[model samples]
Target: MAVYVGMLRLGRLCAASRGVLGARAALFRTWQEAKLQSVRPLSSREADRTSPLPIGGLSYIQGCTRIRLVSKTVGQCLDATAQRVPDREALVVLHENMRLTFAQLKEEVDKAASGLLSIGLCKGDRLGMWGPNSYAWVLMQLATAQAMELEYVLKKVGCKALVFPKQFKTQQYYDILKQICPELENAQPGALKSQRLPDLTTVISVDAPLPGTLLLDEVVAAGSTQQHLDRLRYTQQFLSCHDPINILFTSGTTGSPKGATLSHYNIVNNSNMIGERLRLHLKTAEELRVILPSPLYHCLGSVGGTMTCILHGATLILSSPIFNGKKALEAISRERGSMLYGTPTMYVDILNQPDFSSYDISSMCGGVIAGSPAPPELIRAIINKMNMKELVVAYGTTENSPVTFMNFPDDTVEQKSESVGRILPHTEAQILNMEAGTLVALNTPGELCIRGYCVMLGYWGEPQKTKEVVGQEKWYRTGDIAMMDEQGFCKIVGRFKDMIIRGGENIYPAELEDFFHTHPQVQEVQVVGVKDSRMGEEICACIRLKNGEKTTAEEIKAFCKGKIAHFKIPRYIVFVTDYPLTISGKVQKFKLREQMEQHLNL
Candidate 1:
């Protein structure tokens, strides 16, 4: 999990540990006045009813649950919930000192959607949102799109409007926007005509307006007119559940980012299913408060955090502008937040706080631990120290609306710690032999593939690229090496792609190697991930310098300063004469990683 103070981005369990489940019933009773509708202890067979195997005993599992899928658009779902719980608190941003009821949040979202339309943003127009987690981020996320990787994403998607904060930390977003579209200096507000970004016409500043940019307040006010309101109403009528609603960037091995296009149907149902697993549907609006510290740009925040709350009428408390351990702890105590959403690393940060014991996090009954697998020790700490007994693990890629598997609240401690839980309701998962392209037997590791409503439509405008991962039958090849037992519990063993997940951010080694190849003194570069105590995995770059040329690690770090995300920069840089090679001359990255681990004593 990345934490940013200003404007810049910075970068579980054994069977014996199952003792905590002994008091599971008591824990639920404390959280809810009445008995929970579905908190009963479940045997392993009762918890996950994996379908019987076929004649071949293939590694396949289809989720079987009484709950049916919700077939409505995201906007429609929010509208229905607002009507049911208009007086209930829908959002609370503590740092911003902002709180909104369900009715008020719906009003704000509709007004913002109108504002976007008033500025010539029509249906299907791509709009990019850039900033820290805030009320504004949530508003724009529901109104339109949310993204990062400014220049590359803007150019790739041909965004019609870009909404960003004035500045974050030391990075001046206005200045960065100016660099991308210098015409902003001379053009009128909402009339940007840039030679570099021809498709981008409107620039929106969340803070004070800059030259040729419209202030967010101005956009919101513009929609107050009757004429704009009528247009907004007309536009909503044309919205469809299958229409693409979000474009999240995920790095590929091809050294460029692929925009995973998600539709309203994809996310709305996915979030609903997730809420069902957490038993959020059983709690009232007053009883469920979710403390979310994850950044809104990722799926964990947008789909898992925001949409789930909307679907279940749960109050969402923005812990802080960014991920701050102290602030998160304070929010739970002050707001009586019932659930906390974060990665294992985030849990570590909170648990390590010197005054952690002083805070009253007992209100936190459960949340999600995602991004990467959690160690058994960390799972124990979260349950024992933080009072997150119902916490569960989630697994998915951006392409699948971000969540395909999640543990039920009543699952055994061993299942929660060892696997990513059973397949979500209405989804199908199967493991295939990497080389044979055939289904694998149970308990055998293979490439995991998913087929269901959760999968993305395709990579935005990249048909060929989309075909590489998504098959004709709509099974998205996750490229994750996983094994599924007869009970349908899945364990991720490794990745087919060399994507280093530092914190929660995914960094592609090929992308970094491509960037390093541009360095003057670098002849070849190989990037790999090494074990990291806090970050799960840290990047280590092994470079072969050009003949008779030399460069220091500091020099390489300096070169990467503004060129890529700060998290992608290698934590360890090694100069090598040549990489370990096989008899056939292929570079052996495993051997290279072993050598680095020995060198760093990690």
Candidate 2:
């Protein structure tokens, strides 16, 4: 007992001398070890099934490998909202069956900061928020940013990466770290890989703490009072609008992942825009609910979906650990969900269910879908029959906080179904001629460019790559093919580079794909144009039918009758069961196109 007390006193003295104290906390290492020693260890699968978060200080270092920002960007947004709605329920994990009010969330965030500081974690640390849609995961992201200090930290946010370990153990973490960064191969133990990664000395796992990782709660308990409060103030003051907020690694199914650098302003404003579009400002809690099946690493999942729900004082209902059609509809009904927002495939997944209506979705307010050009008929089913008349069509990229354009609730049936809607109130977009930055004539389809609050900072560790996408004036080259009409409404046709030129006529897959979405038995579909001999190119449809359903090319062509022009319909149809998707849920249509071309012997 004397030895334990003596060590605690010595650690406190050392902490005081270093000026890294938060709220005085008991070092939890001894306590947790004792507690855990008493409980039987669950098998790896059972442990995973219990908690999605990694159990360590890995959250502290998740995003810090390349520190991007300086202030409490999103955290401040939460604070501002919490000031007015302190008692409002901000987060709820339906499966965990736990809810946190804004004030309660603040308290937990503060405690997390204190814990992070008690350990050697300083500013510019990488803390991974890898988990299913859960409250704790969200809290880890904000809290790490809040506790950043000028100590031995390098980066402040985790450059987004997938958790490699099926189950993490502390002893083997160094081995795991190698898997994370093969470049660290030559680095000496206990030293950073480089000065560019200053303050990126730790990896805070949000789930099971690995052998080489620091247990999260233990760090919190070990932190001194001064380090905690100083971090709180640092977070409140350090985070700013232009400061980097998130470094989302574009899912690299196509190629190597590119790090998309999002600013606090980008994310905060993105959420604000969605809230504004939906009229979701500080609404009463019970009257609002957001249901989605996307992972938080995706732009739509973070800025538009969860943050919008949090800002509006609404409850966020996470749909699944994995995409299950039955579970999605059930979550909506179980939560009496007001809003269902996700990729077009998500909706298709639900509709494919044999008994989608079995879920109690009577309380749904409507839904929003992105990821692909939504079939208008699918939109009609979600909004009209599913009773979500207020559903909207929104468009964006990871570089734009994932939202730049949106459809308004007031849009007519045709407008809502056809156009991607107008530029958001604070966002501006222009069509650029194929050559240079020339503004295209009104109603001319060309490259879509945009700039506004929601634009990201730049790409992390890839200045050349960033410059290629974003212009000198911060306008992002969206690469999307779109035409703004006389009313300033923007209709996305397809990607500029993705356009198919058959003989002389230009074919945009999205426009043609919309026609396929209306088919009754077409559960999911992607339109891609393949090279042709005389025509230069020909269109094809990679189709997925609903369960217990069948579709023929003739039947699909008939469904497109009158609804689409003759040349726009896919000449080739290949049924598929799955798609290659990015972390954000966008299909890798290019890959699909390649496969289809091979199948067709084109």
Clash counts for all predictions: 7, 65
Give lDDT tens digits, candidate 2, residues 1-602: 00000001111111111111110111112111111111111111110001112123111001011112212244444555566667877666665576677666655555555554455444433333333444444444321111111121123222211111223223343354455455444543233343444333443433465533445545545443665656545544433345443455554434555556555456555665567666664335665778867655565665566556544556667666535567778887877787877778777677667786677777876557775677787777777767787788888877777776677666677888877766664566767787766777667787888876667667656779889988888778877888866666678888876788876888888876776666667777777778888898888888888778876788877878787778777778788888877545567777877888888888
Question: Cα lDDT for residue 333, model 2?
Answer: 80
Most accurate candidate by lDDT: 1
- Per-model TM-score, in order, reads 0.76, 0.78
- What does candidate 1's lDDT look like per residue over 75-194, in tens digits? 667667777778999889898898888777776655565566567765445556666777767665631222324676677677667667788678687887787678898989888898
**Residue 559 error, candidate 1, Å:** 39
